[model samples]
Target chain A: MLERIRIVLIGTSHPGNIGGVARAMHNMGLADLALVAPRCEVITQDSISRASGADHLLHSTQVFATIEEAVADCTLAVGASARSRTLPWPMLTPRELADRLPSECQAPSARVALVFGREDSGLTNAELQRCHAHVHIPTNADFSSLNLAAAVQVLAYECRMAWLSQTDNQQPASDPGDTVRPVTVLEADDELASHAALERYFEHLERVLVAIEFHDPDKPRQLMARLRRLYLRARPEQMEMNILRGILSATEKAAQRKHHHE
Target chain B: MLERIRIVLIGTSHPGNIGGVARAMHNMGLADLALVAPRCEVITQDSISRASGADHLLHSTQVFATIEEAVADCTLAVGASARSRTLPWPMLTPRELADRLPSECQAPSARVALVFGREDSGLTNAELQRCHAHVHIPTNADFSSLNLAAAVQVLAYECRMAWLSQTDNQQPASDPGDTVRPVTVLEADDELASHAALERYFEHLERVLVAIEFHDPDKPRQLMARLRRLYLRARPEQMEMNILRGILSATEKAAQRKHHHE
Candidate 1:
């Protein structure tokens, strides 16, 4: 899973940041490092020195002319952006992105790229649009300027956590059949709804609400945003989501009948 | 909450890593950095250069002679360790630790110190014992060696996430009275059991287990460790823990009565 993850840096301005990123990747056992048209000297002393003992990553680091070329082989490309754009793309927190990766990278030779943009400006709209999804590392809203390497470290850490969880799932059950059970169990057994399924549900929900005149699509203020926050927090199961969609469908049919009668 | 988090680095070997750590802390809005008996010079060019724009954090960084001195006033001190010790202390993943912090730091003047050990060898057994709990950043099992600064960045990110969640919770609910409700919701209403309360419960639990002869205290293999993991993961509420303790007390009384009958 770690091998399937490629860390792509776009137009990095500082040699130190390049080195810092190498160190961060090495720290989390991620070795595939790709740079997209970096402005700094990648092999400078500052980079090597900052990389600590991870200078070897710099030796084999691949440099690309563009983000597309760098992540050409990746099935899922996630762009890390801190700023909000006019058109919101599908967004995931670093942890959520990590959770979604294992299944995506299950097939042999499947690849995923975590693309990071320049330190100051970040990814351009066109660059961001090219990616499948955007990842936001939740930081202090007031002072949300994260150092490039630090951002990599946070994402890399989440990737490692996801990999560990996947490995734990694969491990054979070791507990004896008859043992003193714990007083309190941790996790519940419900499977969480997938991102794609949830997105489809949201679209269906919005259309139904508009048909019923519950929400005006033209004057939609914070309704969708608030609903997104609520559902994202809830992380409903597939069955629960199906139940919700059923309710929405019934409501839409009832509203249509009332409209015809009027 | 971020201000309450004090990042303590103990016996740091490299000046550059200290600077790197300072940079990471500042990036995540953690202003309190404390160094305990660092081996290298703190104000060196390497430290300043590595700090980048976070030199202010370095300038006002607190220096202490011992871990005890550094975290004496802190209510919660979490030690960061990659290696498992012979006696497994209370362990939390970075995320779990983050989830537990906001409430703990809600009190005015409440302080929480995140302690990191030296580069080559981590915290001494004595130093780890002093901490209330240990936080382990999930990394590649095969290559679990993380650079100190990278480790700081990961924890700081988690801390920031926790702070953000807390802030989001405090925001005014802007949704109209009537709307399409979300199918799934995430968090429960139970306030997690505090560390101090949990520790007291553990002591009582061990005594009861010994009285009932359910667990042999003489050669306790991983009983306590396993129990700690279960409870920590469960994060029982105050009422839940009280119920558990009541059950343990009842079991102990029954065991005593059976012993008398025999």
Candidate 2:
């Protein structure tokens, strides 16, 4: 759905804004960019400067004579509108537009175009009418004037957010929440430290703690218990447990070496 | 709450980015802007144009000499990171940050800051350490060069949306479970370890690890990085941090005592 999403700028006055929009789109994983009769030159040094490193998007931008021609192949077209005008249109928030995209682009050929208008005067009534819905990026009422590129960033961001959520939802088995090692993000075969392994680690740790004089075997004083609680809460993976054991063994060796030297 | 949300740009080389960030913040009803050693002039012609009409934010922006100074008053500081770091820090999505804001700012004096680093290098290790958590804006992996203003726009937009949801709907807190991988469990804002405290803990840990010869300073095989990730994943409370620090001190004492005996 993200790749299917296209950013269309209509009558954009600033060529730099076009470059800005391209960078915004590329950042959010959207590739397709369409320009409909831009008032200013499409590709300029200013635009490239604003585009930063996303000049590939600027280079491959598709030019169209009209909005109709621009979104002709799109199954769904959502115009970025500041506010509703002469006719009331089915308005959606950027989030709502993102939510509707997956289903909207269910078919293989289905394409979605998110259209933006002139910097000063927004989409003309005809252009607004052509869109299936007008998606509004809720901005501060007092200063709702979002820069052309910024608007693209907001919508593209939401689109990417929704896509990420969808991607996460697909992997129920490997869901981070459900996973045993909640934090590590270890890519492969990261089993949790087994109860037996944990017990052995605790024994090794206790011996080292006593050798270091951190824990007194004569008066254990719930030290091991407290340590157990802390380590248990951490839910260390097998690899992490090995690291802990390595440290303990190193501590023991140091203590033994010093004792022998003495 | 949005006004309380400050956008801190660290070493922002481009003055126009400062203006662009100001405009983005203003669009999303955010006001506070802090600059930490900006490389270029704060207010240039390019900045004024990029900021559009939100120059008031630019004009009223606060300048800070350091990250600590910039975020001194903020109770919750979330740094915007691009990808997975070597030492895995607590990561949050924009939505996660917005969702947690209410609880985060329950205290009257609580201020939340969204920190953006230098345009090219992003946040340094030291800068990242100053943040309690890192918020990563999901971008296209291949071309993830999000312009500074656009990055601010995405985060600010999410903040606004979260505010809207909170205002419109009574219950926006829908059990913030394991949506993010690194955050094991985030308790109430008060008990969580402050960035300064976490920094101290890390310093103590490195010292002890070095003393034990578990970590080598010269050919560091990411030993400290791995340890940092493990501890950060645990999200130790203030009390736990104290306990851990005490253990480090004890270990250091034992190591020193053994060396003396030898």
Candidate 3:
């Protein structure tokens, strides 16, 4: 999956940034690198020295005349932009981009390209529109400026994580199925409810509560917002969501029966 | 919150890498950078050029003779390592480390230090043990080598994210009330159970389980371990923990009654 992903830099101004990006890519096991008419010398001494031991990437890097030519073969092209544009495009956080990469590159011939722009000014409006999606690495709004290579390193790291997760899912651990494992710290299970499902659940909950006269819908205070915060904080798993919904349904039925009796 | 994070690079051999780290730290809004017994000159032209525009960090950077002196005032010290060790220690991913920093740095006098090791060899065993926790940046297992500055950038980015999340919570969007707002993305609420409280709960849990005869005290095979993973993954809030403990106490009482009946 990493091999199928190409890192494309457009009009990079500094050789050191190019070298730094190469080192960052190699650190995360990404080898495919494409430069689109860089302003600085790609084979300069500073680049080689900055690459540390990853000069091999510099040696084999492909330089292209245009962004379209550079990413012509890629099925999915993602442009990384730091500043917001007047026109809104499909934007994703770095993690979201990584999560979708496996399916995006599932085809044998499918390729993905992560395009970065110049240091001073990011991808032009036309260049950003050329890509299928845009990735924004959230930073301090006050100091939102991130170095080009540092941005590449972050996205590269995310890609590695996404690839590793896919591999782990495909291959189970070596230990026997029934072994009593020792206390190993584990990450949170990936079975939590999706944003869409949670949204539907919230709607159902709000409707049921309003019907039962728990809170007047027209004059709703912070009840719904507070509930949203609590559940979002919990990050409920599928089973937990089902249980909560079940409780809400039962309460709605009981409330309807009481209203009918009254 | 970022101001409290001190980045300490110990025994760095290359001046350029040191400059790169300073650049990375400043890019992510971290200003407190300390060098512990560096092998090369910090104010050289190589470092200045590598720093890009973060030369202020280079100029004001503090120097220390030993790791102990560097982090003496820090309440929490986290060491970054790419390799696993024989001695098991508390470990956190970069994201997890970031999530905890907001609360950890809330105190007026509290400080946190993120320590990096030499370029060739990472932190010594003694240094690793000295840290309150260890942070492992997940990399491709095949090629786990990361540039020193790149690692700093990743952690610094996470720190910035954490700080941003904290600030956003404190000051919400513009609106007094009565606005049909879109579903705003929010982080988990800051009411999570503290590490100390969780530790105490675990001790109480193990004792209660043993008293109930559900597991043998002499050979408690993975019960506690599995429970730890489950609870840790859940990351229960304070109220949730209280509810869990209440259930446990009720179960314990029921078991005692059964024993008395027998």
Candidate 4:
């Protein structure tokens, strides 16, 4: 994946940021750094000094005269932007981007480029159009703008994480269909009763709610709707529902004794 | 889980590693650092400087005179090691260690201790015995030795990942079974199914065994026992029981078809 990924900085003005991007990529296990029409000199001693230990990668980096040249061989392209675009290339969260990249592009021959536009203007609509996906790194909504290197760092970090998650997913699951189901489906007349058998329990619950003064004749429909929504939202599992029903039954019996005294 | 995790360095020789461990724990969303009879002077100015932004963890860190004192209040204790121990504690892969800790302890007040032994020898047998579980981080077998900070980083990372997973799990566990069943019950279900259900399935399954002549009459019980062990070890879920029943039904139909042919 690292081999396939080319981190492209398009029209970047700052030489130091280009160097910092190199360092960030190295930190995140990505090595292929690409420069697209960079406004600043990307390989001077100043840039190299800022690149630190990552100077080797900066030395071997690919410089593109145009965005097209930067992404020519790339099969999948993701454009980075803090703000929403006019056409809005499908916006992917950091987690989503991390998930999408590795699974969608596995072939070693597949070139994947992440384009970061110039610091001042960011990616143009035309540049974003060439890309398949838009990558958004969540920041404080009031102040969302991030430095070019910081943006590159976040993307690089997410890309590496996404790759790790993909590998973890591919790791042989001990059991197929092991994921837990939310609703309990019990077959009727079996030791476990199915959803159909639970209707009586629901009805009993409604009666108890009415007795508790939570439901009134004037607001029957609204109250029932609210109750149903609450119960459904809670999504009580088989055991939880059973335990709850048991509690309600006990409460009802207690209420009956009070009426008997009256 | 973040609150409970107390990273205890047992007989740590380097002050630098202690500082480094703080950084690792902070990075992995773990606080509550503990030092168990460190050889070097911890909490010094140099150590704090190495700790960078994690000084608060260092300041609040507890220094214990003995390993037992460090872990006495801990409900769950995990000893981190790269290799197998002659003395058996519940051996957990870092992943498994991560999984068990959060499930086993939910009370924010409950203590969970992660014991990392001296940088030179790792956890001693006697020291490891004090732990409830032994966690082995997956590393290259050829070069499994990891720096103290790196080991802490990996285990802390696994723990944070586990904590995040619980958050994800809590987000509407569509399965009613999970909602009501205390996590321990779910874990028990994962370990083994109810004996009664296993017996019932085996009864229906035995007829198929006879039709297939899979076992001789004299060894019928023994074969059934083996099959029981195999499934009990696998810890079949509710859906798995359905699949097993379906297979048994198919086998019965196949036998009936063969009898008609005869």
Best by TM-score: 2
Model 3: colliding residue pairs: none
| Model 2 chain B: worst 10 consecutive residues (lDDT sum) | B175-184
- The lDDT leader among the candidates is 2
Clashing pairs in 1: A234-B184, A234-B185, A234-B186
Candidate 2 per-residue C-alpha lDDT over B1-262 given as tens digits, one digit per residue, 9 for 90 to 100: 6767889999999888888998999998899999999999988998998899999988899998998788876767889888645555667777777777766655566678899999999999767756767777777766776899999998998787766655433222331111222222345334655555666788888887888888888977766665655665565656677777777776787778677876
Per-prediction RMSD in angstroms? 19.0, 5.7, 14.6, 19.2
Q: Model 2 Cα displacement at B257 (Å)?
A: 3.8
Give me the runs in candidate 1 sitting further than 4 Å from their true place: A167-262, B167-262
Query: Residue B53: error of model 4 in Å?
Result: 2.1
Instruction: Return the top candidate by DockQ.
Output: 2
TM-score of chain B of each: 0.66, 0.76, 0.65, 0.63
Tens digits of per-residue lDDT, candidate 1, A118-197, equal 98889999999989999987654456667889899989888877776764433234521111112112222346579998
Per-residue CA lDDT of model 2 for A36-90, tens digit only, reads 9989887899999888889899989999999999999999999998888888888
Model 4 residue runs over 4 Å out of place are A1-105, A111-262, B87-89, B165-262
> For candidate 1, what is the DockQ?
0.11
- What candidate 2 gets wrong by more than 4 Å, as runs, is A1-4, A56-74, A85-87, A108-111, A124-127, A161-191, A199-229, A246-262, B1-6, B31-34, B59-82, B85-115, B123-136, B167-185, B188-190, B259-262
Q: What is the lDDT of residue A106 in candidate 3?
A: 88
DockQ versus reference, model 2: 0.38
lDDT (10s digit) by residue, model 4, range A48-139: 75465678888898887888998998898989976666775577655567777775668867988899998778999999999998876543
* Candidate 3 wrong stretches, greater than 4 Å: A141-143, A167-262, B167-262
lDDT tens per residue, model 1, B166-248: 54433234211112212222144454455566666777877866664545778876566545543544445556666556545
**Please, what is the whole-model Cα lDDT of each candidate in the order they appear?**
0.74, 0.79, 0.75, 0.63
Model 4: DockQ score: 0.02
Candidate 1 — what's its lDDT? Answer: 0.74
